[model samples]
Structures are given as C-alpha cells and as structure tokens.
Target: MSKKVIELDALEQINLDAAGIDIGAESIYVAVPPGRDTESVKEFPTFTADLQRTAEWLKKCKISTVAMESTGVLWVPIYEILEHHGFEVFLVNTYHLKNVQGRKTDVLDCQWIQQLHTYGLLKASFRPPEEIVEIRGYVRHRDTLVKYRSAHIQHMQKALNLMNLKLVNVLSDITGVTGMKIIRAIIDGERDPYVLANFRNKLCKKDEEEIAKSLEGYYRPEQVFVLKQSVEQYDFYEKQIQEVDQQLESLYKKYDPPDEDNYKNRKKHKPRKNQAHFDLGDSLYRMAGVDLTKIDGVDALIAQKVLSEIGTDMSKWPTVKHFTSWLKLCPNNKVTGGKVIQTGTQKTKNRATTALRIAAFSLSHNNKSALGSFYRRIKARNGPSEAITATAHKIAKIIYFMLRDKTDYYDLGENYYQEKFREILIKKLHKQAANFGYYLEPYNMAIPLVS
Candidate 1:
C-alpha cells in the first residue's frame, strides 16, 4: 500500500506590500513580488545615485516596506536613504534569516527575504532616533580615541621601563599633571632625580623622597626620544577627545531638560577614575531626565556609555524583560519533554551589556551599596561570573525603570534587600514543609526557644 504524505501548512501573508534587498559591498540585489509591472529581481550598484533610483523604483512599484540583512556598514546608507523615501525599512539580523535553509545565492537570498517578510516573519533590530544615532557615532569615536590614548600610555610605560624608571610604581597615573611635568623636564635634559621629584605637586600622595628614588633611572637617549614621541601623540589624542566631548555636550543640551534650574542646586558628585572632559554628569542627567549617576557603581562616564547604547527613549523596548533579553543578560532556557535542559545567558558584544558588567565589577569594591550586597550574596552561591551577570541584569532592570518612568533611582539600602531575601527564603521553607504534609512557622531569633 502507498503511504499518504501530509503537507506542511502554508504561511499567511500579512505584508503584501513588502520588498527585500540582498546587500553586498559593491551591489545590492532587490526583490519585489513577481508580476508587479517590475522585474522580480534587479541588481543595482552600491552608490548613492543608484540607491536613490532604487528607492524611486520601489515607490513607483507601490512598495511601502522593505527588509534587508545587516550585511555590514554597507546597509547603513541604503537604510537611511530608503527611510528618507518613506519606506518602512526593516534591518533584520543575518541570524534571523536562516529559517529558509537550502542552496543560497544572491537572487535566492533576496527572494527568500522578500517571502519571509511578506509573511511577517522578520523582526527588525532596534535603532535609535536619527539625533541619537549621530550622538552615538560621536560617543563611539571618542571611546576609540581614548583607547588609542591608553595604548600610547602603555608605550610610554614601556619606554620608561627600558630606562629603568619606576615612575609607574610611585605614581598611580603616569599621565597626571606632576608626572607629565617631570617627564617633560627629563626630555629637556634635566637628569637630576631631585629636580624631577621637585616637580611633584603637594596634592600628590607619594612622598618626595620615594618619588626621587623612583625617578632615578639610567636615561638612554633612544628611550627618551621614544618617551617624548609617545607623550606628544598622547597629548594630540587628548585634544581630539576634548573636541569630541565638546560636541557631545552641545548635542546633549539640545534635548529638553526636566528642570531649567536643576543645575543650580545640583550637588557635584565624586569624580570618576577617568571622567569625561566635559560636565558629563549634569549633561547626562538633563538629557536622560533622571540622575543616572546616583545609581550604585555608575559614574558619569558609565552613564554616558549607557545613554549612547540606548537613547533616553525607553519605548524602543516594550518591557524591562525585553530590554534585558536584547542585552543578552537574561538566561536562555531550553526545555524538552517538560523537563529543564539548559539555562544560560547567550553571549553578545552589546556595548550596554559590557558597560553594565564593568559597573558590576566596580560594585565588588563597594561593600555598602545594595547592588554590592546582592553581588556578594550571589557570588557566594554561584561564583564570580554568575554574580557579575546577575548584578548587571539588576542594573539593566533599574535603568529600564528609571528611563521608562522618568524617575530617579532611590537607594533601598543593602539591609532592605537582605531582609526581603530572608523573607523569601522563609516562605520557600514553609512551602517545602507543606508539600510533605507538615507546617512550618517563622522562627523568632529574639525569643529563647523552649525544648
């Protein structure tokens, strides 16, 4: 007897007006529905004029929406141009387009994307407003510049080490005011350790005698040349970073501030280890409409990074859970046969996640903050990695609430979280006892127990 085969159900099309484009470095292959008085697939050069023409062709075809894989920075220009042309462009991640598996080519890929989008199977990645996008670009470029400056500092340290100088040992920051002055003097042929030590400021914590001892090194001419060049490059990058900071401040001021006079009565917070060149704390608070720097372990620099990753608009994420998931901070649970299999957070290169993790690491040094207490508690049970992820997750939730509600984060205190955690443990114990047909009562530690 012949076996009967069951056919798969067809997906209903929800977006009949959708189009798709397969983006490449030099060309883009766009696909629209067949028999729409337009070629089903057409290849266009990856140029501004070509992109404009493609947008115009889509408009002529009455296409209202488009979906394309985020191949690279190549998609950015087309995305913006299509957006300008009033097309609802969906920038889907490459991973999300793997549902239709088979022999893949340029034409096939574009056709597949068009079909999937027509059935409403594609999800667009979160993108901020155009203004925020511009600000993000500036913020990221500044971060790169700072990294370059740090590399130059390392080069200076290497040069100093070659000369047997222990400046890094005595001075916490070798690029600080006093250290730079001493280094400059050394380059100018001041070889006396006492003279270099005299350049130290009274505010510096290191004693003059120790600094003098540390400054005494076998100064070779080549190493001195290297050090001078390193310092000059570092200074150049510093000026560039300052210009970027000025741009950031100007752009941030364009946002509507919650209170025009709030800056007048604002108390200056403690400076960060590497604070921005501008008044980032006040500017971030005004732009975010909340004082994010008030959160435990968050400083002005961290707040700026967070705001750059995700703008002040919280509506981009529907809920806090969605935001955390997008950051890859939440656990991905796999279940089979109604049994749990695996639960672990998916790794991601998200900047917000990295910034939150850095903040979580800083929390380990603060023993009194609520987040610090929570981190210690989790660390005791799950070790350091889990503790960091948990703490970062908590921070992501706190940020979400602050941005969504336009409210400041009020510290609840470590004791409050601990007390609530104790209550939860007691409730779990009671539930377990009742499952075994027994009753459990709250234990009073203040009262003596009678046998």
Candidate 2:
C-alpha cells in the first residue's frame, strides 16, 4: 500500500523585508528574499569594512529586519552594526534555528533562517539595553578579577602551609586586616613570630600569643618568595577591581542622580567582603527606580548584579510568568500521551538566574522572613535543590512584579506565612475528612490532662 502525502498550506510571510545571516569567524553568509537582488545570497569577509558593505547590501535589498544565529562572539559585532543601522536584529538562538532537519551548510543555514524569519517563526533572544550592557561588562570583569585574586589567595595559603603557618585555622579570612598585615610583615623579612603577631588588629579574635604561635614557622626563602609573588598578584588584581568600580561609578553618573533624602534614609547593610567599594545600593536604586535590596536576602551587590544582567525594563517580559520562564526557573514539563514524562527546569547560564539562586540560598538561614519560611517548607517537602529553584522562582516573580509595577517590596512576616500555610493545611484536612464521610473539628486544648 502506498502512503498518502500530506500537503499543508504554505506559511504566510509576515516580515517582507527580513534577511538572515550565518556569521563565522572569518566570513559570513547572508540571504535575502528571492528577487530582492540579482544575487539574493552573498558572502562577506569578517572585517569592519566588509561588515559595512554587508549592511549596505542589505539596505540595497530593502531589508529592515535581520535574523542571525548567535554563533559565539562572532555575531556581536554584526548585531551591533545592524542595530546601529536601524534594522530590527534578531539574535536567534542556535537551538531554535536547528529544529529544521536537512543537509547543513552555512549557505543552507542562512536561507533556512531567512525562510523562518520571513514567516515570523523566529524569536529574538533577550538583550538588555545598551546602558545595562555597559554595566554588565564592568561587573563581569570585576567578578573575573575577584576569581583571579582568589587563586592568588590560595597560592598564599599554600605557601603558608608549606612553611607550617596556621593562620587559616584562627582567622575567618586570610585577606582580612590582621592576616594581610602579618603576611606583609612576613614578606618584608620579619621572621620573629612575636613581631608578626604584633601586626594583629585590635578586632582580631585571636590574641597576640595565639597569633604568635600560629606564626611560628620555618622561614624558608623559596616559600617566602612564592608568598611575596602571590601577595603582589593579589594586590594587582585588587587595584584592577578598584579601577573597574570607579568606571562603574562613572557610568552610574550617566543615570539620574538618586534622591539624597531617600538614599540617606535607606537602611545600612554591612558590606560583603568582595563587594564594590562605591555606594552600589544608591547607584542601583537610582537605575532600577526601586530599591531591590529592600527584598530579604537580596543585598545591594546581588541587586546590582541582577539588574546589570536583566536591566530595569520589565516590558520585555509580558508577565511575571514570562520573566521566570525566561530565567529558566520554571519547570519545563514534558508530557507524553497526556502523562507528564519529565518536569525539570532547563539548565541555563543566565547570570540573573545565578544571582537569584544565590539570593534564594541566602534565605535558607533566615528565619524571620516569610520567604525564608516558604523556602524551608518547600525544602521539607522536596530536596534542597528543588527548594532552591522553587524559592528562586518566587523571588524572580516578586522582582518581576516589583520592577514592572514600580512598587516597593513589603514582605509579609514569617508568622503570617506560617499561619496562612496552617490554614491551607487545615482546609486540605477538612476536605479529605469530608471525602471519607467524616468532618474535622477544631482541636480543644482547654481540657486538663488526666493524671
């Protein structure tokens, strides 16, 4: 028996002036609609001049929208150029563009993207506004510097360990004031344990005698040299990080100055160890038009990092659900034959999602906040991993609404959440009892216990 072939209606063209580009490290293949020009598809070298010519060619073909696969950093220059030329540039995800199965080549990919985009079958990936992008760059670089500095810190620790120094045992952080001073004194040829211990800060929990005991180590020249070099690298990265902070401060100046009264009235928070030196809370509040730090477990640093990643413009997401879905915090339920086969959140490298997760994790130890209670309740039902995602989802929704509606966060207390949860449990119990041909009555504690 011969199989019947199904002939579906052709997809209607929705973007008449759409074009597609397959960008590569050395060259790019561009495809315009058929009959737009004598040569509908053309290849261009990946040079600034050639990119300009590519834009000019697209203009010649009357293309006003362009779709391109996000092929690493290769697409950034072209995307910026096309956007600058006033074309609606869609930086399409590779996954979306890979659904169509056929012979694959750069030329074929460009044409396929063009065909899909022309029919409005493509979605542009979310990219924050240019101002946010600038802040993101600086913030990311600072994070990198911090990571690099951490490695040098480990190096210093290793050198200390080789020489039998036990500073890490007594101090919370080797980069702290007392630790740094002792380390500098060691690098400066001070071998006397008593002299090194004298550098201890007044706030140090360890007394001079205890610090001196820890400082008693063999003064190996080789280990001392490594410690010196590691400290130098650490200081260098510190300087670089400070420079980036200054740049960020200057960038924040471009935005509207924050309200002085509001800034002064805001609650002061103890700065994190690696937090930027500037008034990050004020700058972030000014940019976002709301103090995200007002939310529990979301400090100014986390707020700054998240805002830099996602920007303050919530219109890009149509709703709070859409925002969380974009962050990949919501579960992607896979159903087969009306049965759920899988339900898990998609793995994503979104920085905003990471920041939200960090904020959620911080709430694990907070007992006073309603969100903390919710997190603990979820953790009791599911495992810790699921609890983190669930709490992050809640936080993401709160952030979305706060930013979208321009409203302040007013956290209901932990007791309130607990009472509401108790009420819900009572209602569930009553319904279950009714289903079992019984009714629930309030438990009485007024009666005295029998002896």
For each candidate in turn, give its C-alpha RMSD to the true structure in angstroms. Answer: 3.6, 3.3
Per-residue C-alpha lDDT of model 1 across residues 114-134, encoded as one tens digit per residue: 988999999999888898899
For all predicted structures, in order, the TM-scores are: 0.93, 0.95
Write one digit per residue (lDDT tens) for candidate 2, span 199-250: 8888889899998999888779999999999999999999999999999999
Worst 10 residues of 1 by lDDT: 260-269
lDDT of each: 0.89, 0.90
Error of 2 at 300 (Å): 1.4
Assess candidate 1 and give its TM-score to the true structure.
Answer: 0.93
Model 2 vs. true fold: TM = 0.95
Model 2 steric clash pairs = none
